[model samples]
Target: MEHSHKAILVVSFGTSYEDARKATIERIENDIIAAFPEYRIYRAWTSRMILSILKKRDQIIIPNVCEAMEQMIDDGITEVIVQPTHILDGIENHIMKDEVLSYKSCFQSISFGAPLLSGQKDAETIVHAIGKRFEYLDKNTALVLMGHGTAHQANAVYEELGQLFKDMGYPHIFLGTVESSPSVQELIQEISNYGISSRNCDSADNDLPVEKVVLAPFMIVAGDHAHNDMAGEHPESWTSRFQNAGYEAESVLKGLGAYQKIRELFVEHVQNAINNINE
Candidate 1:
């Protein structure tokens, strides 16, 4: 399993947010290129809908694992390694893995990389990344992370993130899903239970209205969910939901991949996967 023959495939769930998604993918690709300069590099997007929706005449269309590997084979590439830029081993990563495994015969060897927040080390890195972006608010305010939860087992990772935030001694960190358990409504109820009013009220000391509460997504890119579901003006969105609940809600559009520390997790995962192949 020599590294020289292998072509590194960086795969992501893809995003409709053209500029935002491109920046995230480019950073990961640049990091891999920097580390494994000897290995040929290819980029892929796992979401077909996203790719189709964000397609541009000028930008290179992100290929899938099979398509990228086929291209590598055409270029005389023998060995191949795939690194999924997904945040977890969810549906997107599972699909990529299946596609890569189907082409095992095409290459001398094939290796798959781990998701961004795979293990404890990766989790710590994520926590560090988030910490860098937000400071722990006082007991009066809490940080809420909205993740695109799935029915898949990987969705439990959202709970892990919540626990991590709790262990970090942050003031009552809360987690919610866009599609799974611990739904946004549940999270809102829990937050309201804390007596943290979502409304702007005049400060007793300053005599001025003070807004409290910050909401951020636990996603890799602030794509559809972040833009529409979390921050959209729609009445059913999390932002509107929070507002209706009497809380001032603010949405942080930056996804997990936007953080340098989180990006480093991708690099570490790629390196570890490459090392495993060597072993």
Candidate 2:
């Protein structure tokens, strides 16, 4: 293989689900490879648990960010760009950036790209992508996007994206987090308040009641959270609640990384980070 001093490190909170890891994380890395073929691409995962599991179970050894940086230094690479697949600028993003920045003096030019949903425009793009995906739904159905929320202020991205759905002409859509506000309970209430509930034809316009609700992961990779928490048979799963509420509930079982537009945003962010070398 040819050697390159410049490298792109595609970072992600790795998943143990092989299929999901391929569908989401691998796809994103492939997108990066295609966009920047001139630069060699390396991967680093933020998930220590996943790393351990893969190493123990499959004999696969993937380095963490710190290790990856050390490897790059040993390889005599002086230019680096770290791109995270995290959905928000939350704790994960912060930790990754700090680790990458810790090696600032080792590389002549090192930059960290923005997360998947970094600002207003990113939220709008996500709304449009998801809106297009669920355009088939009518007023009798609601599309609930489930995000992996954090206590960090960046968790606001979930609610912000939810409102953007309305502003972008998809009022039937909603966003909820597994760990924060707009929680499952809040979504039930939001559904009820919006008159989209199938129970209690209390809405003045009974015909407008939602007959179905689709749950999809708004995170990059739909692994454990998507499988067990969002669609699992457990009684508290999102699917179970909607099913019990007299609505036909379905889990999309796919992640944001499955979308082309979403991948494009990450590519754009990487380019922006590469450009930072000049500044």
Best by TM-score: 2
Give residue 209's lDDT in candidate 1 (0 to 100): 23
The CA lDDT at 64 in model 2 is: 99
Best by lDDT: 2
On residues 27-81, what C-alpha lDDT tens digit does candidate 1 reach at each position? Answer: 7788889988888888888777777765664465777667887788888888777
TM-scores for every predicted model: 0.88, 0.94
Candidate 2 segments whose C-alpha is farther than 4 A from its true place? 196-207
Total residue pair clashes for candidate 1: 4
Each candidate's root-mean-square deviation in Å? 4.4, 2.6
Give the distance in Å from residue 174's predicted Cα in candidate 1 to where it truly belongs. 2.0
Mark the 10 consecutive residues where model 2 has the least summed lDDT: 196-205
What lDDT does model 1 reach? 0.77
Steric collisions counted per model: 4, 0
